[model samples]
Target: MDSTKCLPRLGGDSSFELGLECREIAKTIKTRKIKYFGHIKRHTSFLKDVLEGKIEGSRIRGRQRRQWVDDIAEWTGKGIRQCTVEAQDREKLRSVSCQPLEQGRLRE
Candidate 1:
């Protein structure tokens, strides 16, 4: 798949690095998951921990934000919803989350 073509804007701004931007975009991307599109969701999460000092820092390098966005775009386009495995992440999610379909959706 041409990931570059499907890329959405990574939320980079003065207050934070692309890591923080990654978090915001992740939050936005999570919004489209099939079974939970309209539900409230977390944006930063791991990154939020970084900001809040609960964790040391994000392992994600700033240079990778674009690729991350592209990967998420592909996954979301295909209806694959990925959740962080932390117990809190599970609690934050909707009960019946959508998994990826083996075959692509039919189209005209």
Candidate 2:
């Protein structure tokens, strides 16, 4: 049996650790989401209203689904208002978004 086949190989790194790769990918995704949200925040558009849940709709039965902003808040360990405020500053948003997964209690 080839042990290498069972592990993910990162570029130029002999160590094949799937957990590390997953963390990296998660960070990248978080960063992108933050940046995108920031962009939306700076603009006046339907998407913004949608993200903010401004659009009135009938409530669905059962547990409420998590919104994008909720995910951002959870990822940054901040409230929705704080996340929106931070998103206003590009540099701060980038820094917050790049934080390690452990720093943010990500829900499974």
Candidate 3:
């Protein structure tokens, strides 16, 4: 609760004077933590949530590349571990498409 809550605003009073009354007032109310999605890490978390079905995105409709992860887990419940496996699969696919003929020629 205190993680994102204000703690008496560093001490103050309703009359704009330094007093303990204001401190008590601020402590009574609770504050909520902020949730935002930024960068790949956050996307990965959202992907986890997708697998858990904690949030709804299928109703979003259309081509949901970012939200596409949600549909994949809709039928089968998946977790971050599955996401990791899928990433490895993609890497393998990528490696298969590349040509390694120049590797020996470029090396000593």
lDDT of 3 by residue, 1-108 (tens): 457866554434455554455443332211000011112223456554554465445456677455433322331234444533443454532332232222211111
Write candidate 2's Cα lDDT for 1-108 as tens digits: 655556564665534566677777777777788788888987889888787765468887999887767877777778888878877888888787677346664456
TM values, all candidates = 0.21, 0.70, 0.18
Candidate 2 regions exceeding 4 Å error are 1-16, 100-108
Question: Measured by C-alpha RMSD in angstroms, how accurate is candidate 2?
Answer: 5.4
Most TM-score-accurate candidate? 2
Summed backbone clashes in each candidate are 0, 0, 0
TM for candidate 3 is 0.18
lDDT of 1 at 20: 68
Q: Cα lDDT for residue 89, model 1?
A: 63
The candidate, 1 or 3, that scores higher on TM-score is 1
Off by over 4 Å in 1: 1-66, 78-97, 101-108
2 or 3, which is superior by TM-score? 2
lDDT of 1 by residue, 12-71 (tens): 464478656765555544444422332223454554444224335677656643322233
Reference-based lDDT, residue 27, model 3? 28
TM-score of 2: 0.70
Ranking by TM-score: 2, 1, 3
Q: In order, what is each prediction's RMSD in angstroms?
A: 17.9, 5.4, 20.4
| Model 1 lDDT-worst window of ten | 99-108
